[model samples]
Target: MVATGWRPKAGNRMPSPSRLAGLLRDGRFVVTAELSAANSADPEATWRRAEVLRGSVDAINCTDNTGAHVHISSLAAAHLLVEKGLEPIMQLTVRDRNRLALQADLLGAAALGVRNIVLMSGDDVTAGDHPEARRIYDIDSMQLVEVAAGLRDRGTYLSGRKLEQAPSFFIGAVENPFAPPLEFRPLRLQKKVRAGADFIQTQLVFDVPIFARFMAMVGELGLLDKVFIIPSIGIPRSARGARYMKEKVPGLHVPDSLVDRLEKTAAARQADEGVRIAVELVSAVREIPGVAGVHLIGIKWEEGVVQVAEAAGLLPRPTFSPRASVGGHG
Candidate 1:
């Protein structure tokens, strides 16, 4: 059974006032891990994976049709995590939903006690298994952030109608620091902050120096103080995996040096090297001035997250008072 007091009911005791938000506000280094929904109907595997990350992570991020492939809904997956006494960061992409659907889902997620949300303009359908699927772009991610913030701050919808009970969500947005036209990236982040992003999670960052430069630019613009910046860290399982990420994935910049390091390592030991690299990156990133946290994306290699967190000295997360309530319509 799930732990007591972690249930999403109104009167149940809360462990903390949203661990991610609290950590960011208190200037503490935060750690979050992504938990993608399984393609199958059974949730046992997903729950088991989440169980392993309980004490090591601050929040579990539920992906929304990641890579445009359909899976269990992110909202449903987040609800499952909540049932298991784990905090979930619900990801909502604008690729499939219109304004009405988005608003409805936001309200439903809030009712289910999901406190954090990551907004994105999802990957194109052609990139997924179902290339023939029709795409919807009713509103982009920026507008979605504005819409969510409007509900929280002003108790109103984008249409100017006031909400009787606005959903309180800790808004988040995704960034690709290694994306082309490098200089424009920080400007894009500033736009999201202006649109009301409470935090920003970046894409897989293998180029530490480039990411550091990006952070420096962000700090120069004074955007770091406006929003919590969490760089995404990935641990490739093999040299082939690293090569695929560097060559195939758009907006992902896995440096050639990392690839060479992985290639030179014995085939059996490549995974270990990946973990070491992740640990090194985490340690290096922790020293960077503007980084509020690290979001570890151990795609299919969940156990590696534990190894990286432990090796990087990010385990044994701080415990907060149970008196703090998480997400709700304020």
Candidate 2:
């Protein structure tokens, strides 16, 4: 059963809540995919990708200026996904916006029919191509959760201003269990939960033992009953890609054994090997007691997302209620 206060009302007359939210609330395993907005100004490309992923995954996540390299805004991309009849998890990062901008975007996104949102602190501009860009983190991701939940439940903004109508949103946040000072990771998750995170999507996790330890800690803290936990998994398309992630990415942890497996495979077959490894990870993660679901991050490898989900036995997604609110605009 879903924790109290998180379940959507059965009699809700609005478009049914997002399928992703409903599944998590019902204690059902879910599969979500991430779609990177193209660097170019073509919305069609993103829509086509969402079209291909249709019915294969529960929801598609639109990243917000990932790596600080500007692309289509996450809200715009999410809107396009909604137009295509796909459920979108709108990613909101705190790196580039102040409190006012963030609050405005939140309301605007909800008004445009986005129901699911993932809050992130975001990567520094130094990590992206534009090192000269100014960084503006007026509010971190943890606080953003509090603000969002206020808008949803209290019908007020962070400033205590009441709204004529509150937006119904399924709040989400990200976690990096493999990050340094591993012992404190679960505690960090607790903070997010306290701030009103309904679900958590972790960073790329290749070390099962480490992730298992993280989950164990979460269970110990009784967070397993508080929020849905979904760890992110990725398919390394090439040996070079694997190496870059292991070395360049700060919080991501890619096991050396997996990197070696990719190194031994031929370049042409590396993609297939990557998919196989991802499938194995998915199957393994599902067995973790507290894991509510899996989020596949198929960066630049869209087709692999389908293959991984299907191979991991996550295909043939459970039927969502037809009465389910299509999108929450009000």
Kindly give the number of clashing pairs for every candidate: 0, 5
lDDT of 2 at 302: 78
Cα lDDT of model 1 by residue, 1-330, tens digit: 011111111211122256567655555677899985787768786798788888888899999999888889999899989999899999999989999999889989988999889999999888899999878889889999989888877778889999888776778899999888989999999999888777899998888899999989998997755677889999888999999988988778888999999999999999999999999998888777778789998887789998999988886887762222433201
Q: Supply the global lDDT for candidate 2.
A: 0.83
Q: Which ten residues in a row have the lowest lDDT in candidate 1?
A: 1-10
lDDT of 2 at 145: 94
Clashing pairs in 1: none
What count of clashes does model 1 give?
0
